[model samples]
Target: MLRALVFDFDGLIVDTETPLIEAYGDVYREHGVAFDRAEFERQIGHASFAFDPWRAFGAGADREALEQERRAINLARTERQPVLPGIRELIEAASAAGLRLGVASNSSHGWVEGHLRRLGLHGFFSAFGCKGDTPAPKPEPDIYRLVVNALGCRSVESVALEDSAAGVKAALRAGLWVVAIPNAATADHDHDGAHWTVPSAAEVSLPALRARFGG
Candidate 1:
């Protein structure tokens, strides 16, 4: 029986992908390098830190400088970030159904918290686990394991809602069932091992989730 629902913060819970992509593109333009959206998605989606396109452009970019630039752009964009459609309703429904809620994402705690606060959804989660909270980020089971443990639920009694292949792998590796909601940025990625790959979280009814986990 599923006792908890874990979520990925960025693309899954909110529509932050477009803003992130725009930010990266803006930063790249400063250095006279065009940012390739597809390439950026492929690389940065799998890494904890933002990729430095200037370095890839052979500009001898310093990692710290790129990080600073990325941070400034991200913060500016985040101020206007909005939650995904039906996200609040789904969260409220899940909460009303008595499902424990948690957040596990590759983003830093500050980034996740800022977004959540902006959307006024910060209080819905019982626990928030971020990249720095765990020994490693997504594709690693540590963060998912931490959430299940914090929720006081068995791994088998928990379900993780993710939008990326890496997030699915991490949740599954942690012994929880996974429901994938692939976003535009990661829709082309393979989710062959996911228990289900839905178009959006709005389509994931509470009954369907419970049924999948035999709760």
Candidate 2:
């Protein structure tokens, strides 16, 4: 039986990833430096990649002030970030069906948990696993493994919903069935490693998912 459902918190649940890229780009623009969206993309859902925009912009600018502005821009953007489609329905359905729900992310615990709480989605998760809770996060499978254990479910008996290449890779590596539900920011990410790549969050085939996984 599919006893659990694990979710990736950033791009999957909210569009925080896009705003982060935009904020960084905004900072670069203020410094008269061209921002490489592709460069920022590498850092999504994994901490293994580097994304120091000031380095690209030159060192003359006040790094602390620029970082503060970037943080403000990002916070403003995320204040209005919409929860992606079908997520609520999926969570409600999972809950009604007695499936354990979890959120595992490469982000810090405060970031993911705080947003979920603000959105009133925090109450739905049985487990919240993030970078601090594990030795490694996405692209390492440690976070996913920790969440599955916390949910009291076998890896094979759970499904992971992800939006980025790193997250998909992590879930797949953890031996869980992975579903890719890309948002605008992650639309171009490579999801070939996922078990199923759906067009968008709304079109995710939960029924098909269950049948394929013996739920």
Candidate 3:
């Protein structure tokens, strides 16, 4: 039975990836350097992909200042975005269905929790497994294992909602049924690995999912 539902935070819960990439692109524009969007997109949903944004800057560039600027832009842009369509409905449906709700992410707990709180969604999830909670992040099963165990759920009894290829990979590795719903930033990713692929969260139905996977 599907006893739990786990969600990926960034692009899944909110479209933070779009604003994040835009922010970096803005910083690069200010410095007259072209941003490598494809390269940065590759880092989405990945915990430890080695790529530096400042490598394009001059030798004397103040990396710290650039980081601050990027953060500010990202925050400002992110603050303007509303919760994605159908996410609230899904959460409400899962809650009413008596399934444990959790978050599994490659992001830090503080980052995930803070955004959830700001979005008035922090109270919804019963468990969270983030970067420091495990030795590895998405594309590995560590964080997913931590969250499912925390929720007292067997991997096969849980379903994961993910927006990235790496997130799908992690959930599958952890043995959970996964639904891939691509957001603007992750729409180009290969999500064929997921058990189901939907254009948006609006298409997900609790009864349908339970009927298909809960048994």
* Least well predicted 10-residue stretch by lDDT in candidate 1: 43-52
Query: Which residue runs does candidate 1 get wrong by more than 4 Å?
Result: 49-52, 59-67
Order of quality (TM-score): 3, 2, 1
Q: How would you encode candidate 3's per-residue C-alpha lDDT over 63-139 as one tens digit per residue?
A: 99999999999989988777788888899889887999999998888888988888898888999998888877778
- On TM-score, the candidate that comes out on top is 3
- RMSD of model 3 against the true structure: 1.2
Better of 1 and 3 by TM-score: 3
Quote the lDDT for 145 in model 3: 91
Please write out the lDDT profile of model 2 over residues 1-215, one tens digit for every residue.
88899999898889898899899888888878888888778668776456566787566768899889999999999989878888877887788888999998988889999999898899989998887788776788899999999999999999999999999999999999999988777787888878888867777656776887885
Q: After superposition, how far is residue 33 of candidate 2 from its true place, in Å?
A: 1.2
Order the candidate numbers by lDDT, best to worst: 3, 2, 1
Candidate 1 lDDT over 1-215, as tens digits, reads 77899988878888677677778888788878776888767643454445545566565667678768877887677677667766788788889999999999888898788778878888889988886888788889999999999999888988898888888888989998988888888787777688988998778888877777775
Give Cα-based local distance difference scores for all models.
Answer: 0.81, 0.86, 0.90
